[model samples]
Target: MSYISRLGSAFSKSSMFASEFFLDLYMYAHYCGISPFQDRRNKTYYKLIIETHAIEKGLSLANPRMLFGRKKITEIMKAARRYGIGSNDLPILMATGALQDYLALHRSAGLSDPLLDSIDAFLKDRATASAVLGSGGLRHYPDGMPSPSPEKAALLTSRFSCRMFSPEPLDAETVKEIVRIAQTAPSQCNRQATKIHFYSNRERIGQLLALQAGSAGFAETVTGLVVVAFDLAAWGGAQQRNQGYVDASLFAMNLMLAAHAMGAASCPLNLAVPHSTERQIKIVGEIPKDQRLVMMIALGRPADGPLKSAASPRRTIDEILTIRDQAVAAA
Candidate 1:
């Protein structure tokens, strides 16, 4: 039996191994800083069975007397061996199953907001990111919940990617702290495969901005640019298959949210600058050649116009959240 199927079977089983195995995988993803749902669309068939089984097992966990036993766990292992481990079902299956207990255990950590904020950045339309610093007040949650803002819904309602920039320049330390905030982004298996490039050169900043803007018309007044990326060497040039890019990207997104929280406007850039700019950056900036540029951010005060930058439109949750016919059985 394949290792994946064994894991799936273990996870899908409505008995002891179900939630416990899920909990293990959840911790692993958390440590790796990967979103459980972020890329599951890439592998859906293997995931379906695990997700369906997890729900059934979760129900059983609630009521031990009915269909909940070691024997059920045995079924899950058997099923997993048959189905495989890297299944798309693993993400949701892990999410909806053991995650509750996992969240319950980590309730004190309050890491959920940053993680949720990162997910929001990926799902929402973003134009750019920034390097602004936050006041001490910004870090404190007025009413501490496992969510963002004084109201739990603040994460959903008020969070947005910042666009536009002022002529002002942020201090190097401020940029350092903003990157420092990103430094906390979880890495896969604690590999910490990420790095940051701080750009203060107005000319270079404008160049990147223009390339991303599709014209020389990018906000010329912008003063800060930060390149978020991952160091391939961190993976030893062999762990490429470990999927570290997703981890770094998610970390960068969280940094963008933290910047917004700190009362600064920013933009996320795709770094499509010409090879010349890339070479200049590599030479002058001393950037590692193997690091993959995950994303870039332009940070500064908002220079107001007709509001050239606003939150782009987003899909309804219903669009992003599909209800598989069987997964909806709980509904």
Candidate 2:
């Protein structure tokens, strides 16, 4: 769904169909609205050809399965975090595949569904910020620069979300470095209720990777993973749902940034396995069955990938910040 200058501008409309099959599909989708001479046979060909190409292309687009299966989902997620589409696409792809969903949603609904949205949500600063945050990226100003010396700016600036990685083992000391950094992350009232388990041994790594893959990475990448746990007893008293996540996430970001500083690339993966799967990982890691699993981290040296994976797309500043009523009053 990319477009160049239209006919009579740069390339002729006729020229597009000759380029790539996707381009051909684009041309046909466009022509469907204009051309009267087009027949059912031509339309059918466009449908069939585009559907075939889209599915194959989608698989190659950013599949983590190419690396290994759930055994390496962290690798897949590192790539996905860099490209947000990977996370969003998986469940959908898992549910309906690429083409079938596209046809039902886009083709049948046609161009209308895409362009029809008001796009107001996309235009909002908060919405844009949330999108970036959810995608594991930090939001920024419009001109592609961060506000001078803001929180998380350094972390976000140094992060590239990684595209590829080596199938190598994480050095024990390297794991220690990451653990040290994460342990320093602030906790509620200095509760310091978090603990980390480093698993690189093939036997243990295999179990953890399995839990991760069934959850959707298709494979676990690299040699080790860091399992972050928060003691339920740490927060004590009544704890809100958001508190658990917030405390964990704050610490998680600290760890990720620290990984980069220590000359390693890391991605935050999930523990989305079934209860049984999670139980297996905890036992293999010998966590004593008392602490709750907060999150997991995959770490290693990054691999070479398409485009270097450094160019991060971001929202405009005006698209991410706004003054609250109290803040505005203070101003």
lDDT of 2 at 115: 24
Q: How many Å off is the CA of 136 in candidate 2?
A: 14
lDDT of 1 at 214: 24
- Separately for all candidates shown, the number of backbone clashes (residues 3 or more apart, or on different chains) is 21, 20
Sum up the clashes in candidate 1: 21
Off by over 4 Å in 2: 1-154, 214-220, 240-244, 304-320, 326-331
Worst 10 residues of 1 by lDDT: 131-140
- For every model shown, what is its TM-score relative to the native structure? 0.48, 0.50
- RMSD to the true structure for each prediction, in A, is 21.9, 22.8
How well does candidate 1 match the true structure in TM-score terms? 0.48
Tens-place lDDT per residue, model 2, 1-331, is 3354443644654444345556656777767833665675444333433333223232322342221222122232233223333222322122123222223333343444332132122223223433422221122223322122446666557564443456766678877877787777887777676677777776676677666762233234556677877666655323233365667778878887777777676667777567787688778888867677877877776543431232223434764688565445554
Question: lDDT tens digits, residues 1-331, model 1?
Answer: 9999998876655454455666767877754324565444433433433443333333322121222223433443334334443232333333223323322323444545443343234212111221221110111123222124677657445544344355677777777677777677778788888787778888787655554552223456568877776777666322243456688788877777666655555666666566666655566556788776666777765543323222122334774788777554554
